[model samples]
Target: MISRPYDEIKLLIENYLKKEFSTKSDLIWSKPPSVELGDISFPLFNIAKELKIKPEELSEKIIAEISFPDIVEKVNLQGGFLNLTFNRSIFVTQVLQTILEQTKYGQNSSLSSERIIVEHTSSNPTGPLHIGNFRGSVLGDVLGRLFSFLGAAVNVRYYVNDLGRQIAPLVIGYFLLKEAKYKIEEKGDLWLGKVYASMYTFLEIQQLKQKLSMLGWKIKDSSVSLYRLDDTDLKTVPEFLNSLPKENEEKDNTHKWFMKLTRIQSSLIERIPEVYEKLNKLTSSKIENLESTTNQYVKNYQEGKDKLIVEKFREVTKIALDGHVETLNLFAIFHDDFDWESDVAWSGEVQTMLAELEDKKYLRHDEKARLLKNDIIAEELGYKTKYSISYEIPDTIIINSEGITLYPCRDIVYHLHKLEKFNASQCYNVIAKMQQLPQLSVRLALYGLNRTDTADRIHHFDYEYVSLIGRKMAGREFDYVTPDELFVLAQEEIKTIIEERNYSEEEQQNIANKIAASSIKYHILKMDPQKSVAFDVKKAVDPNENSGSFLQYSYARALSILSRSSKHDINVQKILESTEKENLIIEKQAEWELVKLMEELPSILIKAAKSLRPDSVANFSYSLASSFHKFYDACPVLKAETPELIKSRVRIVFSISKCLESLFEVMGIEALEKM
Candidate 1:
C-alpha cells in the first residue's frame, strides 16, 4: 500500500492538539496560498477560543510546545494561523519508496465489501456504434476499472438490446436484401447499418409519394365535381387546375418533407444502390404489409412461437453485436458479460413480475397499453418531497397493445436478474440523458411492486451526447461515423507525426494505433459526464500538451532516461534505506513540485470513485505529466554534477513511470515503452 503523507501528517497534528490542550479538534486542512508560506495550514481561532487563549498567543505556544515529526521540517506562526512545511527529502523518499513497494500502488479497500454491477454501451443492435455510443462505452469501462481499483467486486456488463423497434428493420432487411448485390467492403456492422438505413429511407420515400399524390387529388376534387362532368371538365382541365387551392400550407409542408426524404434516399442509394433498388421493388409490390410484418416478427419472436424467426432475429443481432465487440477490442474496452434483453424477456421473469404486480394491484390497463401505477406509488412514498422531485411522473407503459414488452419493464426485470445473478448490492445503468424519464419509471415500477429496497439501489448513470464537429448522425438514416471510421481518422492524423520517427512501417502503424486509441479514450474521459463533448481528433492526439499522447510521451521519456542509466545510478533501494539515517534531498523546485503532484494520486482516485467522475483522474494524470515535463526540462538526470543527484533523479523518474502505468490501466490507455 502507498503511504498517504498528508493524512498521516494531519493525524500527527491531531495527536499534538490532544496532548497539549486535552481537546479534540475537527481540523480543516488547506494548502498555503503560496509555497513560501508552508505546505499545510489550519486556523487557531476555534482552538484558541476553546482554550481561552488569544489566537496570536496560542500560535506561538504551539510552535514552542509542538514536537515536529521527521516528515514536518518546521512550523511557522503567522498571527492566528500555523503553517507546517514538510521535510522535502523525507517526503520525496516516502512517496517513491511506498509506490515501488506496492503492486497496485494507490489501490485501497474503500469498496472492498461492495458488489457492484455497471451496465453501459447497451446500444440497440441496429447498427455499428457511432462516436456517441463510444463515449458511454469508455466511461463505463473506466468506471468499472476505477471501482475495481478501489477493491470493489465489480461486474461490467453490456446490455444487448436484441429485441426492440430499432432491431426490427435490420431483421426485415436481412431476409429481404440477403440476395441483393450490394458491396460488402465495410465491416459487418457498417454494412448492416447501411441496410438498416436504406430500409427506412426507402419506406419514407414511398410514404411521402403516396401523401403527395393524395393531396394533389384532394386539390382537384375541391376545384370541380368529377362525377357531374365528363368531356367539358376534361377539355377545361387546365381551367379547373388553375382554380385549385393555391395557398395550402399543408401541401407546401408535405412537398418540403418529400424533398428532404428524397435527399436522404439519394444518399442511401449512392452508398448501396442494390439495397435501395431491392427495397424499392419490395415496397412497390406489397409495401402496405411492411408494418404488419415487422410487428408480427416482433410478436412471434417475443412469444417464442416461431423458432425460425427467433433464430433470424438472434442471428442478425449477434452479427451487429460481434462487430461492436471487435471495434471496442481495438481500444481494449470489454465487458465481463453480455446480457440479452430477449433472454430476460423470455425467462418468464417479466411475466412473473407482471403477475406479481397485478396481484399486488400495482398494474393497471389503459386503452393503449398496460401501465404501472406510478402516481399512486409516488404519493404513498412521498417521493415528491422525500427526493425533492419537482416534476410530475406519469405512469410508464410496461406492455403495449401489440403484446410486446417496453424498455422500462424489461429494464426492471433485467435489473432484478443482474442483482440476483451476482447478488450485487447495487446496479448502475449507463444510459443517455434522453432516457431519464424511463430510468426513473423503472425505479417507480420497482417501488410500486413492493421492492423498494431494490428500487433504491438501482442507479441511472446517465450522460450527455458526444458529437463530432460538422458531422450529423441520424442512426436510422445511417449517416454517422462508426468507431472504425473514427479510429481511422485518428490514425491518419497520427501518421503525419510518427512517420518521421526512426521506426519501420509496421512499428509506425502500431504506434499510431496505440496513440489513436489513447487519444479517443482520454478525450471522452476528460470531460464532465453531464456535459456534451464536441470531440476534436486533432486536439485529442496532440503530442504537444494536455492529451493522452502527451502523457504517454512523458512516460516514454522517463523510461528512456532509466534505460540509459547504470545500475549504480538507478539504485532506489540504497537511497530509501539511507533515508532512515539521513535525508535524501530534492534540491530543485521543479523536482519538489513534481513529487508533490505525484503524492495526490491516491486522494484523487478516492474522490473520483466516490463522486462517480473519472474526469478527475484524467485531469490529474495530465497535471502529473505536465509537471514531469517541467522537471525534466529544468533538471538533468543523466548529466547531474554529482552521482548522488543522478541516483536521486533516476529514482524520481522510475516512480513517475510506475505512477503513470497504474493510471493507464485505470483509464484503459496503453502504456507504450516507446512512442
Candidate 2:
C-alpha cells in the first residue's frame, strides 16, 4: 500500500529535477532511523554535488519548489537530507483499507504477459535427495511462486539426468546385486544409493591397485585381503611412494598414494568394507573388466542398439523418479514438466545444436573430439579476458572420444528447447555453485550461436551446499542424511511438542507432517543463496524462534483472537471507513510501528521479486511477526478502552494475519490454523 505513494514521490522528484536543474539522477529513498524523524528520507548529496551547490541549500530549494501533496504532511530539511512525514491517521487508514480491499495487494503487473520456466532439483536418479539438494528445490519452488504471484506465466520443470555417467555405475550395481535382500523396507532410490556407493568404492580400490602397479609396486593377494595394515607399515608406504617421481611431473605419485589412502580411510569410516563384501559376493567379473562393461552399457543405451539393456536402465530410472516424486510431494512441490536428458539426446536436438555451432565456425577438432572454441567465442562476444590467479578456462568438449555427447552439450539443447517449446522469455536454472563454470560456458555458447537474446534471459540461480551442524557428508560414500531422514527427525520433534494435545492420531500425524516440511523449507530459504547452510533440526522446529513455525504460530494466534471477538460482530470494511471520523487513533508507539511494518509488505515483495532474493521476504516476515507480537503485548484489542479502539486493533491484527499467510504461501510453507 505504501509502495504506491513511495513510487509517486520518486516520480515527482525525478520530474522536478529534470525541469528545474535540467539534470537526471537516480532518486533513492530510504526510511528514517526513527519514526519521529520522518517516514522517508532522500539524501541531497549527489544532486548537490552535480549541481555545484551546497546540499542543505539544495534540499531547501527542492522542498520550496515541489508542492506537498495531501499524503505529505510535512517536508523538512535535516542536515543534507530531505525528510518527508506522512499524515499518520490518513496513512494508517489508507494502508489498512488497501489491505482489506485487495486480495492480491502486493502483486504487480510488470511481467504479466511474460513466460518463465524455472528448472530446479535436477539431481541424478542414482540416490535419494539429501538435505543439500532440498535447498535448490525450495529455492526454485519459491521463485516460481513469486513469479506467479506477480502475474507471470510460470512453468516449473525438473530435468531428470538419467543418461549421465553417474547412472552407469548405478545400473551396473543393480545388475550385480538384483537378488540381494534386506529386511528393512527401502525406497528404490535408497537401494540404488547403496549399490552406487559399493560400486564406487570397489572402483576406487581397483584404481588404487592400478596406480601401485604403475609405480612398480605389487601387493600380494594376502595383503589385499586384509582390512587394515599396521600403522608403522602404512606410514612407511607413504615415504616409499614419495621417493619415486615421474620425469614429466604430470603424475604425482606421492600425492596419488596419499589420496588413495584417504579414500580407504573414508571408506572405513563410512562402513564401505561391508558394502564391498556384499558386492564381491554378487559379482564374479574381474575388477579390470568393470569399466569396460559399464562403458559398453552406456554406449549401447545411447545408440539404442541393445533393447534389453536400455529397457532395464529405464526401469531403474523409473523407480528412482517415482521416489523423487513422492519426496517432492511431501513438500507440496508439483512441477508442470519433467524433462529427461535422454529425450533431448534422442530428439535430434543435440545433433541439431552441434550442426548449428559447426556451421557458425564455433566448433573445432581437438584430440579426436569436437570442442567449443573458447577463443573464438570470447572474441565474438567481445568479452575481455581477466586471468584469475586460481582460475583458467578449459575448452568445452561437446562430444568425447567415445562418440557420446557430454552433459553441457545436452544442457544447451535442453535450454533451447525450453525457450522454444514454452515460449518462455526468461528461464532460471537453480543448480549448485559447483556448476557455475558449466553454466557460464553454456551462456557463452549460446551467445556464440547468435542467440544473444536467449543468453541474456538465462539465469543460473546458484547456491552453496547445506551440511549438518556438526557432521560432514560425502555423497559418493553414501555418508549423508537423506531428506526422508530429516523429515522423520523433524516429525519426532514435533510429535513430542503435540503429545499432550487432545487431537486424534490422524490429526496429530497431519500436523506433524506440515510442521516438519515447513521447518526444513523455512530454514533453507531463510539463508542467502550464496551462503552455505548448516542445518539444525532443533532450531528450525522451535515455535518461538525466527522460523516458519513461529510465523505459523503467530497466524494461528491471530485467528484465535479473531474467533474470541465474535461477540463484537466486527465488520472490517465499516471499521476502515469510520477510522478517521471516530478518531480511533494509533496512540501507542507499538500500534503505529506495527501499522508501518505492515505497510512495507508490498514494497518488500517488489524488491524481493526484482532481486531474486527470497531471503528478503523471509526476513521481512520475521520482522512483521515480531512487531505484531510487540503490539499484542503492549495494546489490548478485545478489552481496549473504547469499542472503536478495539475495532482499530482488530483491523491491524487481521491485516498482519493476511500478510503472513500470503508470505507463507509464496515460501511454500503451510500456515497452520493450530499448532
Candidate 3:
C-alpha cells in the first residue's frame, strides 16, 4: 500500500512497453554511476529482443517519446541506456512530504516473518574478549539488527565452547603457573605470542600418542596419505587443493587436535591485529613497553622454554586427537580425562538424520561407502550446477562390533554431531573462501532443521578482518587498536583537534564518535564474509569521501536548512512547476534527486537486512548524504522568498532529517546534532 518513487517509475515503464511495443515484461530499473547520469536507467537489452530494432535506436526513440512530468528535469540517452534527471525543487518538495508523512518509509517485508537465530562471539568465558574475537561478535550482532529491520523475528545468541578441552588447559595453565601474567615486550607487534606459545609444554603427550595408536592412525601414515574425493561421475578430482598437515600424525586429524590448531590460528589471524594495535601508543618509542613497566611474576613451578615440550605436546595431540579431551580447559580436561565411573558426558538430545537415496543402494566396504545420486531427483527441483550443491558418495568405512560387521560408528558420530549443531537456517559456519565448495557440499549432504525453543532461530552473519593493509588483521597480531584503546587515543586527538579548531567539548566528542564508529563499523563490515580483511585505522578514520563524518555532516546540513525555515506546515503532494535559479533550489535536478533517495529507505533497509550486511545501510546512507550536500551547494533554499517556494523547501528538509535519523541508528551511527 505504501507509495514510492520507484514504484511510480515502475508503473510508467510497464505502461511504456505495453503501449509502445505491445510487450509484457517490465524493464528493470538500473542506477548509473552518477546522479547526473540518471535517476533510473532502462537498458534495452531485454526489450530489443521483443522489438526488432537495435537497443541503441530503441533507447534514443524511448528517450524522445517518453512523457515525463514537470518534476522530472530531463531525459537523456547514453551508452545505449535511457537516463533521467529530476527537477530539483519538485524533487525536494515531494521527498520532504513523502518521508515525513509515511508511517514506514524505509521498511520492507522482503524476508516476511522467517524465524532466524544468529549466534556470534561464542568466545570462551575465561579471559577478556580481547580485540581478536570481536569481529564475529560485531558482525553477528549487526546482521541480527539488519534482519530485524527487514521484517524478521531474529534471535541473537552467543555459543560458549565451555565444555571443551580448550578450557581445561587454560585452567590448568593458571594453576600450574600462578601469578601467570603476560607483558607486552618491546615495541613489537605480537607481545603475547611467545608467552602463550610457551604454555603448551605442560600437557601430557606420552599418553596421547598411545591413544592415537588405538584410534588406528599411525602418525607417519596420517602425515603422508591423502584422501581423494571424486565427482558424481567418479571422475578423479585434482589433489592439489587441500591444506597440508603441520606434521605427520594421526592426532593432527582428530577434531580435538584441529580445535587447538584453529584456536591458535584464530588468535594469530583474528585477534593479533587488534592486539598489535597497543604498539601505536608508543609510536615514538620514547615510552616504556608493557613488559618493562610490570615486574615479572613468580611461577609455582619453573617452566623451561624448550623444544622437547612442543614435541611431546604434539605427540599427546596425535594420541587423543580429540580437542574435546586433549585441548580442554580445566572443566573439559577434568570431565574427559575421567574413568567411566567418575563423570557423565554431555550431549544434547537433538536427534540426527542423513538422507538415503531410496532407489540406489550404497555399497559398503572396509573404510568407506559409495552410492549413486539420481540426477532426476533434482530435475524439477531447480538443483543443478548453477544453484545446486551435490555430494559424491564416499567409499564406506567398515567396522566390526561383536563379530557383526557394519559401517564405522566412530566416523559416523564424528560427522553427525558437528553437522547437526549448525545454528542457522543455512547451518551457518565460518568457512574460508578457499574451502567454499567443499564445505557447502557437506551442508547439502547433511541438511536438516535444527529445532530450537519457541523463540530460538539460527542466524548467520559474516565480516571481513580488520586489516592493516591487504593482510587479515589477527587479534593482537594485526596490531590494530581495540575500540577501547582507540577511545583513549581519540580523546587525546580530539583535545588537540578541538584546540586547533577552537571547538567545544561537544564538538570534539561528536567528531570523535563519528570517526571512531565509522572506523569500527566499516572495518568490520565492508569486506565479503569469506574474505579476510586487513585493517588501517588511518584510512578508516579518514574524513574525506569514504569516512563516516561526511554522512554525518550531510544529515546535519539538511537539519540546518530545516531549522532556519519558519514555514514548516505544508502538504507533501503539492508539486512545484517552476524553472528559475531562484526556484532551481527546488526546480533543479539535484533537489528531487535527493527526494527520490529519501523514498528508498524501507526498501534498502529490507535489502540490507536480507543480505545480513549492515554495511549496505551504511553505504546507502553515505550516498544519500552525498546527494543532499550536492543539492545544498548548487541550490540555496534560504534564497527562495516566494511563500509557495519557501513552504515546499521547508517540507523537503524536514523529510530528509527524518529519513537520515532512522538510517543512522540502523548503521550504529549518529547523525551530528549540529554540523
Point out the higher-scoring one by TM-score: 2 or 3: 2
- Model 2 scores a TM of 0.90
- For candidate 1, what's the RMSD? 5.3
Off by over 4 Å in 3: 15-26, 31-39, 54-90, 124-133, 176-198, 201-345, 348-442, 448-467, 470-481, 499-515, 528-531, 541-546, 560-592, 609-613, 634-646
lDDT tens string, model 2, 1-675?
Answer: 344566778789878988889876677888889777888899888888889999898888888888977778988888888999987776777677778767766766767988999999988898888878878998999999888888899999999998887677778778666656533258888777777776665555555655555666555532333223335436645665666664636247546655655665556446755555666555444333566667887877776668898887898898888888888889887788889887777777778788889899888887668888765676557542422223345677878876678888888887766787689989999999999878877877887778778887889999999878786777677778777877887888888888988888998899899988887778778899999878775676554453777777778788777777756676555665564554336779898888888887887887888999978888898888888888888998877888768878888888888888778878888988777
The lDDT per prediction is: 0.78, 0.77, 0.46
Clashes of each: 0, 0, 69
Taking all chains together, the TM-score of candidate 1 against the true structure is 0.89
- Residue 102 accuracy (lDDT) in model 1: 76
| lDDT winner | 1
lDDT tens per residue, model 3, 1-675: 435666676677678778878986567877878876877777777787778778888877776777777766777778667777766655554555556565546655666546455545544333333344555555555565566666666554433333333333333333232222335342221222322332221122222333444654353433211111113101211121123344636434544543343344345434444332222222113222122211111111112133444343333322222322221221111121111100111121111222232222222233334322223322323334534546432332222322221212212222344323333243233222343333333332222112222112211233444444554433312233444454344444445544666567777776665555544555555555656665555554444434466776777788777555545443333432232234424566676677777777777787666555666776787788788888788777756656665556656666677787777656556567664
Listed in order, each prediction's TM-score against the native is 0.89, 0.90, 0.60
Instruction: Report the Cα lDDT for residue 419, model 2.
Output: 81
- Which scores better on lDDT, 2 or 3? 2
lDDT comparison, 1 vs 3, better candidate: 1
Q: RMSD for each model, in Å, please? A: 5.3, 3.7, 14.0
